[model samples]
Target: MSTADDTQKTKDPEYLSTLERGLRVLNAFDADHPELPLSEVATITGLSPAVARRCLHTLLELGYVGKNGRRFILKPKVLEFGSAYLHSMNLEQVATPYLQKLRDQTGDSSSLAVLSGDEILYLVHVSTERKIRLGASVGTRFPVHATSLGRALMAYQPDSVIDAYLDTVELRKFTEHTITAKAELEKRLRKIRQQGHDSAQDELDYGIVSVAVPIFDTNRQVVASVNCSTSTTRVSREKLIEERLPLLQDAAIEIELALKKWPFLANSLRG
Candidate 1:
């Protein structure tokens, strides 16, 4: 999509210009660019300098942003927004125990994730105390096409939804193992649908291998996915599947049964 299209959408009367503009400014800072100057923020967000300044100043007044020299950074107060969302969902509280069981059984990191746009959003992650090369925390988002969790979730989605995503997404390669072709990704999703699980190795990050299975709600609709991931050095692809696939699948069932109590989430979290 073109910048014009995005700008046009933001012009709709129902949309709040300040909210959109402020979020754009806030999103300009990420892991790679933790600190950005006003000019850089405007350039990154496609907002004009005047608008960026106004948004930043508004955030500063709201205690969500801080300034050091010419650079602007997100403040700790901004975490309240995420905390509120996570607390309200209660997904972490529900899924952590099951993920912990998988972590303990496999001696690896396990996670629960849900579809968010064309990505998988981590809702809970349980990791061993041992240091690891790769790990994701709650709220981390990863490209759907490159993650087993994403494929497991998508495999259960209607064909039209999957096709819509494939038609719009540009599959960028993160590693040699990443499926950059739409046809290949479609084939993978189909296979996941047949096999009831998905696995990936060096797809998103080198040395990070994972297996994931779709999580279903009370009505049998897939709402989320559960995964166990580890470093390549610690686990072979075959062993990872042999050992953790059952655990992950069982955890999915347990989570599904547990999520029954939260009828709102069971109904609302479907892709």
Candidate 2:
């Protein structure tokens, strides 16, 4: 992509096509694609081979990407970007201790996340040593329609935004319990509003049960979410909620209060 290409695509005259193309190339690499051939990168990013090659060459020179034989792979240097953003926000610093407390109290895994696009991106995750299924960490993304964290943050979105989400996202079922119907999910969101939190049992992954609460900003806007997860074999959905919901709410409140000092951060992450 170039300045000339912008005439056919974006209306912004100041748009930098080279930077956008480079980022598109980088975005092509993900958990499922740890290594991708040059041709594959071009295909995935919808870039011509010449353009993708140029972008990869630049990243390779900058040590942000490495080539292993015929395939391209992201280097540790790329993490500096995400790490810089996390350090700047400082949300993890304020919320991790509370998440740890939730884990300790419930003997389950706890996590912090925010709505990113149509998914919930994990910003912080505190896990128990005893793992069952589906591992997650910072930067992990899951469909917002299938997890407690997703429902918690999404239930508070304005009707227009929620309508846009429903219009855009593909409601694919991850498990038998996953809500794949728009009407049903709309009802669920209403119920979440009536109560104060969201819970999922065998919705995203089988045997996984989690409950989450939305953390709000000073303006009462939902900014992020925190969740505690365990297994269905160990804890029933009712038991999980009975024991963990209040603790999750307390954590959300504490995080909200702590975020007041960093008012910019609260708004920055508002979903």
The reply for model 1, stretches above 4 Å from the true place, is: 1-13
Q: Per-residue alpha-carbon lDDT of model 1 for 120-232, expressed as tens digits?
A: 99878887776665678988989999999999998899889899999999898998989999999999999998999999999998988899999888777889999989888
Which stretch of 10 consecutive residues in model 2 shows the poorest summed lDDT?
1-10
Best model number under lDDT? 2
* Per-model C-alpha RMSD: 2.3, 2.7
Instruction: Name every residue pair that clashes in candidate 2.
Output: none
Model 1 has a clash total of: 0
Q: Assess candidate 2 and give its TM-score to the true structure.
A: 0.94
* Deviation from native of the Cα of residue 88 in model 1, angstroms: 1.7
Residue-by-residue lDDT tens digits, candidate 2, 1-271: 3555557557776778789999999999998999999999999999999999999999999999999999999999999998998899886678888899888888999999999989999999998887778889999999999999999989999989999898878998988889999999999998998898999988888989999888898999998989989888889999999988888889888898989989878877873
Per-candidate Cα lDDT values, in order, are 0.88, 0.90
Show model 2 residue runs off by greater than 4 Å: 1-9
Tell me which residue pairs clash in candidate 1.
none
